[model samples]
Target: MSNRGETVNIAIFTNSYLPFSGGVPTSIKTFKNAAEKLGHTVIVFAPSYPGHKSNGKGVIRIPSVKAMTYAGFYLPVPFSTEITKAFRRYDFDIVHVQHPYLLGETGMKMARKYNIPLVFTYHTMYEQYLHYLPVAESIANPVMRKFTTSFCNHSDLVIAPSEHVKEFLSKRNIETSIKVVPTGIELRPYRKKFRKGSIKRKHRIPQASKLLIYAGRITPEKNLKFLVKCMAKIAKKDPDVMCMLIGKSAEKDHYEYDLKDIVKREGMEDRIMFIGDVPHDKLIDYYKEADLFLFASKTETQGLVILEAMAAGTPVIAVDAPAISEFINGKNGFTVPQNMLKFTAKALSMLRDKKRMKQMSSNALKTAKKHSAENMAKKLIAEFRKVKPTQDEYENMRSLKDLSEIDWSDVIKKIMR
Candidate 1:
């Protein structure tokens, strides 16, 4: 193992990456950028996107086909000669994977081959997103749960983005060592001062309008229809309030149309604006311009955008969920129950109280500072150090006749428990 302060070489395998906008890609990018700055080397293996050119410095693109279930995402081919060549060239101390299947499985195989410690970051609630699978939910849910549990057990370290996720994995009987290291954001951009109302001015919204912003992929799992209902209620109570949904819809599932339709039905066409696909660098300006950040997604493991909004000093009003309830308090923001009436009431109350909002905004900034990229990267490095094998351990692992010795029946028995 490398010395405590010595640089470590990292191999990251993920099903998704740059040019694809989502939490997984964003988290990978953030960690890569921050870790590189700290003199560590990170090589990422990800699916190649059509018409997207990669710089090819540290990222290796695996040939992939577009997934039928997910519109924009591509399914990576498991076997790659390029990845084999990379293993021969780079001496990786640890292999970190972002998903449990496909590319993640490949990562596991490669880690075993090289006798490197394996780390898996459970970035999503697989069961919550099983609707994307062509198989029936009843069959898919339990199978996915079992598969993920087995995968986590195989990993040397399992990273949860929040304490709730860690607890959830424990309940599912994941025997691997679990750590909570949230996807962190660069604090400078959010902390920097920008022209306050630039986003509103660009969208032709009045400067005095109270803007409520929600940023993320527009998919069914996000529960955006509920947010529209909440927005409609808030708009009815305050004529000066407006909402901006700042993301594009999934390629296959254009749920944004449904949201627009709901907005129209609520008679909020003028009040609710669909500002689609803003660049990540420019998103901080929108967050800064917003009076409050609105999030209703119950499926989130970390709700990364909520933290991004808080980083920009925007108080968030989120629906109570395991991950959300961990950070959002009365000081930073409010996390109300899923009930629309209660959620909307808290939002309206917060909007009406200027002094309280200002105090919360200050508290939110402090909260964001605690989750900065540098801090999270240090935590990740520490975990990596704990799991990384020494030279003698690596040699012993390499001497093993077969690395794929896990019993599926045993994994199933544990899942049943």
Candidate 2:
């Protein structure tokens, strides 16, 4: 075997995948793409959603008996028989699970039944999901902690996307091997050029305006209302300050255009611009066009967009939270103390200082260089090599019973008849 190690096939399982348009989906795509480039065969199993396509190449959609459809897409519950059966035939060397709960649990089972080593990447803190699940913290927190710890402990390796998440995983007392590997950026040779000219013309952002760009989904966990609130405060002081709210909204009433209503009601509409979801291919243009990037989300295992903005030579202004604070330590960008008013004022300070803007751009570019796909691939490849199918388990998996003997004809007859 080459010193880089023998190429092993890996199957990744997640709740959502590409063309779904979210940070997690994008990170999943990036890893799959990078893994493939490293000569490892990679495939994913995810649900088909609206405006989402599954070519069925390297992807198998799970059938759900019960689903919660939203925006024309259905979320499959964990351990759907289709998923369990579909995975059995794949014969992967390793199963890497992303996200938590149902689908992740399915991955856990596959690792056991198929004798494949498993790895789990903890991408989000489900602390926010408890309220959505309508469960009290006393009940939900323990459950979340239990599942998280259990999942990590089951894995051959648990990859944390940020130092903050690694620490979080450690605190839960997950005894598995843990590694911190960043979701990397595909650095462009002419990326700096993409920054200098793209933002100014494409978005109609005036050269005189101090553009503050925010990327990613306009979701609740982002803590975006404060961004609007901060914009209003900044608008009160400087009319030339323009806040461009990019990305698709998660909730119509609670998240999106309503923010515009708030801005208009406050007579601050002129200062804040809501530009919905920018396509991935042209995202670099938006970064290049902006003078500074503003990210206030308290929820992130790692903010890939923050690195993207920095890659475009745009400094980020983010709340001092987890992954955000880990990558930015007052060197490449400014970190606010999660105080809304303070964040607004800190953003406001960037307006009058042209020299500081230029310095931050250089610093951002310098810091962003550390987060590249090659670096991440090295770490991920190491983890993949550390895991192997054992003699007994491998033999047992090959002898495991197939679902065909279970007689699913009754269920099919009931559904069709």
The most accurate candidate by TM-score is 1
Per-prediction TM-score, please? 0.92, 0.84
Q: Candidate 2, which segments miss by more than 4 Å at Cα?
A: 1-3, 54-57, 64-73, 77-91, 134-138, 189-205, 388-417
What does candidate 1's lDDT look like per residue over 224-274, in tens digits? 999989999999999999998988777433577788888999999999988
- Give candidate 1's error at residue 225 in angstroms: 1.0
Task: Encode model 2's per-residue lDDT on 1-417: one tens digit a residue.
Answer: 123577767778887766667777778777777777888777787766554454455776664332221232245445467666656665577888896555665776777777778788888887765554433567767666665665566567788899899888788878877888889876753254444545656667677776777888877788788777877887788877777888886566665766777788879776788888777777778787777788888888998999988888888888888788888867678888878778877877776777888888899887777877657776787777776543334224321222222222332333233
Clashing pairs in 2: 199-289
Q: 50 in model 2: Cα distance from truth in Å?
A: 3.7
- Ten-residue region with minimum lDDT total, candidate 1: 392-401
Give the Cα error of residue 41 in candidate 2, in Å: 1.2
